[model samples]
Target: MKLLMVGAGLSGAVIARRLAEAGHRATVIDARPHIAGNCHTERDPETGVLVHVYGPHIFHTDDAEVWDYVTRFETFRPYKNRVKTTARGEVFSLPINLHTINQFYRKTLRPDEARAFIAAQADTSITDPQSFEEQALRFVGPDLYEAFFKGYTEKQWGCHPSALPASILKRLPVRFNYDDNYFFHRFQGMPETGYTAMVARILDHPNIDVHLDTPYAPGMADRYGHVFWSGPLDGYFGYDLGRLGYRTLDFERFTETGDWQGCAVMNYGDPEVPYTRITEHKHFAPWEDHAGTVCYREFSRACGPDDIPYYPIRLVEEKALLSDYAARAAGEEGVTFVGRLGTYRYLDMDVTIREALDTARAFLSGGVERGVAGVPG
Candidate 1:
């Protein structure tokens, strides 16, 4: 079978690789010139530092299969993400660890004492929290919530926490101990040669052809035996119902001597500050050394028509719109929508790859139509 894979990101690349390995021909297309999509990394022309072209993406996953799969293409160096935040004229560790709790409150409470103390501070009245604000207040209480999450969440989403879902705030781990590893994933590391090279390897198979700067639309489906679309779900349907919500990022890049922030990611968690975080690219690849450092002050805003959507804002209305799109997708034959944009959900790189692989395996097994049991409307 001849397949057309759209977006050429982790999902598309992995799907193409899987299909090609199964003795099927697959052609991959990406609107961007790059292959890795948001996770694209390249060398800075001026400073000679490795720069994450879009933003910092730490490859972290608990699945051994995913870890083994990614490492096959490119060697991964051990990298544990330890994030920092600047708030109230002070620097603190992220994920609300014991150190963060003690420093913010000016107390040296142990794990047990801190847990009890925080439980006391929480608003127990709101048992079933609906919004991000209420969830934070209920989980970590008012002081920590305001200090760590309130400003950052507002800036990142471009809205009040009250308007956002509780699921967003609860995504991060709340640890009583001092363990500051950003992700709890069993496998956490960055590719030694960066994400672009890793994805390039996945698309290097002879049965797979890659077309850069190409957007695969619905009309292109006629030319292929099947279509695997990783583009926006709303875009496939021409926004007939309504446009879904997304938060895109604007990166302010600058060159600096020596180190910047002494870490890879630093959050500006105060309302006074505009950008949500600053990322030092070189720190992501600690195995490589450079006298100069490249950094990006990441600003988040509402995603426009031409903007690259980074995070999906799956509010109640968008969920309704997504349901409509999913229903439509279920009725459309010979077209399979995968990945974050296609599914209309935020996804890590591993989950995207895993799902793409699963989609391809299902397709090769020949049990379903267009890799789905049914077609979309």
Candidate 2:
């Protein structure tokens, strides 16, 4: 069978590789010049620092199979995401851990004491929270919420926390202990060389043909037995039912000699600050040493027609439009929606790869017919 994989990112690459290995010829096409999509990484010519072209992506997951699969292509170095934040004119550890709690309140409270204190601070009056603001207030109280999350959330989503759903804040943890690791995943690391190199290896199968800078066109799927689209779900339908809302990022890149920031990610929790976070590229790969450093000051905004969509803003209005597109996608023949954009959800790197593997397995096993790989829930 001849298969077509659209948008040669992690989803397309992983699925294409699996199908190719199963004695099926796969052709992968990417609109971007590079294959890794948002995960693309390249070394800066002048600074010699490996820059994460689309932002910092730390591969952290509890899935052992996904970890083993990625390790086959590239060596992964030991990496833990210890995120820091600047709030109220002071630097603090993220995730609202014990250290952060004590430092912010200027008290040397133990784990139990801190937990009790935070519990007392929480608004027990609000039994069930609906919005992000209510969720934070009910859990961490106003002080921590305002100092850390309020400003950052507003800047990232371009809306008041009250307008957003509580599910957003539910993902973030408020640890009582001193563990400052951003993610609680068992396995956490980064590709030794870069994500692009790792993806290149994944696409290096004999039965797979990769074409870059090729955009998907109407009737392109006519020649192939099946099509796996990882591009925007609305884009596949020419956004006929109106475009789904998304939040895009604008990166302000700068180069400096010597170490600029000691940490890999430094988020600004002050709403007054224009940018949300600053990432030091060299710190992402601690194994490699470079005298010069490269950094990106990231700012998030509403995605326009011409902009590269990052986060899907699934508000009530967007959800209605998404439903229409999803229904249209379900009826489409010989096509399966895959990955974040296709499913219209925010997906981590590990989840994306895992879903891609499962999609390929289902197709190979003859379990999936058409438009059933990754449909929006």
Candidate 3:
């Protein structure tokens, strides 16, 4: 079967490669001039430091199959994301870990002691948490919430923490132990040659043709047996119903000598700071050494029509709009929606790859119509 894969990111590349290997022809198109979407990484022209063009992406997952699959394209060096935060003119460990708790409270407490201390600080008044603010208050209490989350949440989402759902904040762990690794996953690493190269390799097959800076038009789907869309769900229909909500990132790039933050990611938790975080790109690939550094100060705001959407703000209104779009997508006979934008959900790299692989395999086995994330069979 001939296939059209839109957006040459991990999703499109993985899907196209799989289908191509199965004796199917695939034509992959990306609006951008790159293969990896937000995971595009390149070396800074002057500094010679590896830069994550969109933002820093740490590849971490518990799934062994996914990890092994990624390793086939590029070798990954062991990299644990140790995030930092600046609050009230002080630097502290992220994920509200034991050191952060001790440093913030100015007390030396062991794991058990810290757990007890935090429990006492938690608000017993709120038995059932509903909002992000309420969940933080009940789990980490007012002081920690105000110090670590409140201002940051407001700045990142451009709204009050109370307006956000509890599920958003609940995913972040508040650790009692001394472990400062941001993610709790078993396998965590960064690609040696970077994500773009990794994906380019994935799309390197005889039966696959890649077209850069080419956007898949509505009429293009008619040329192929099936279309696997990884672009924005609203974009597929040109926003016929209504535009969904998303938070886009604005990066302020700079070059510096030596280290900038001495860490990969540093969150500015204070609302006074306009940008949410600063990332040192060189730190992302610690295995490689460089005298110079490349960095980006990231700012988050509501996504516009011309801007690339990053985080999907699946608010109540957006969910209603997504449902309408999904219905329209279901009616389309030879199209499958996969990946973050297609499904209108924020997805990690592993989850995106997993879904793409599944979607491709389903297609190869004559079950192309059926898929996860409302892809009708």
lDDT winner among the candidates? 2
- TM-scores for every predicted model: 0.97, 0.98, 0.97
Candidate 3 lDDT by residue in tens digits, 261-289 = 89999999998999999999999989888
Candidate 3: count of backbone clashes, pairs at least 3 residues apart or interchain: 2
Instruction: Give the number of the best model, judged by TM-score.
Output: 2
- Best first by lDDT, ranked: 2, 3, 1
lDDT (Cα, tens digit) per residue for candidate 2, span 1-377: 99999989999999999999999999999988998999999989999998899999999999999999999999999999999999989999988899999999999999999999999999999999999999999999999999999999999999999989999999999898999999999999999999999999999999999999999988899999999999999899898779999999999999998899899999999999999999999999999989999999999999999999999988889888887887788788788899989888899999999999998999999976555234453
> Could you tell me how far off, in angstroms, the CA of residue 60 lies in candidate 1 after the best superposition?
1.0
Which segments of candidate 2 are over 4 A away from where they belong? 372-377
Residue 278, model 3: Cα distance from true site in angstroms: 0.6
Name the regions of candidate 1 deviating beyond 4 angstroms.
369-377
> How much lDDT does each candidate structure score?
0.88, 0.93, 0.90
By summed lDDT, the worst window of 10 consecutive residues in model 1 runs over 368-377
Model 1 scores a C-alpha lDDT of: 0.88
TM-score of 2: 0.98
Q: lDDT by residue for model 1 over 201-292, one digit each (tens)?
A: 99999999999988765578888998888888888888889889999999888889999689999999999998999999889988888988
Q: Name the 10 consecutive residues with the lowest summed lDDT in model 3.
A: 368-377
- Kindly report which residue pairs in candidate 1 clash with one another: 328-376, 328-377, 329-376, 330-375, 330-376, 331-375, 331-376, 332-375, 332-376
**Worst 10-residue lDDT window, candidate 2:** 368-377
RMSD of 2: 1.1
